[model samples]
Target: MPRAILDGTVLAESPNTVVIEGNHYFPDESVNHEHLTGTATETVCYWKGTARYYSAVVSETVFRDIAWYYPDPSQEAASIKNYVAFGRPVQVEL
Candidate 1:
């Protein structure tokens, strides 16, 4: 199983996760929306398409752009669509 944590809080956990480039992409339902805030941030990957970012708020601190997901991935990377991946400042425990 994989879990996403921040500031001692478990933000998301799932047994079914997709690993791409060493990052575990948790399914949409596994993410806890309560701790997330939408950000006007996006970056494009040549093969993954557009990735949307999100900020996580925990213990009064906001970690910006620490999480992202591709809602409409390129055909080659379609398995991760709608799945979320967390980066530094946020921890993914396996």
Candidate 2:
């Protein structure tokens, strides 16, 4: 199982994760929605399409743009569509 943790809190965990470019993309249902705050940020990935970001809020701490997902991924990366991946400030454990 792979897990995403922030500030000692588990944000997402799943056995069905997609690993792309060394990052584990956890299924949407496996993530804790309570810890995520949607952001207006968007970034384009040549292969993955546009990625939307989320800020992880644990207790009183907020990690901005620490997580992202592609709502509609490119054909080559369709399997990871809508899956969440963590970046800096968010720890991922496999």
Candidate 3:
């Protein structure tokens, strides 16, 4: 499995991290929500529907819009509807 880490903390870990529209979508259970702070930021994906974001704050290091999820994803992308993903310098390793 590969894990996404930020500020020395694990953000997400999964065996199947899908990249859609450039964002890496990890399984919902793979994310560590304790360090994630929901934000008002959102963007529409033509096929994925509207995606919401979370600012991952760890050890005083805040990565803006580091994580996202499609609350109401399109049927085609439904598998990752509630799943979260990372971006903007989020590091991933096995």
Identify the leading candidate in terms of lDDT.
1
lDDT values of the candidates?
Answer: 0.93, 0.93, 0.85
Decide which is better by lDDT, 1 or 2: 1
Query: Which structure is stronger by TM-score: 1 or 3?
Result: 1
Ten contiguous residues minimizing lDDT sum, candidate 2? 85-94
TM-score of each: 0.97, 0.96, 0.87
Q: Rank candidates, TM-score, best first.
A: 1, 2, 3
As a TM-score, model 2 comes out at 0.96
Cα lDDT tens digits for candidate 1, 1-94: 7899998998889999999999999999999989999899999999899999999999999999989999999999999999999999778888
- lDDT by residue for model 3 (1-94), tens: 8889886788888898887776678888879899999999999988879989999888887888888899889999988878898886788776
After superposition, the stretches of candidate 3 with alpha carbons farther than 4 Å from their true spots are: none
Clashing pairs in 2: none
Top candidate by TM-score: 1
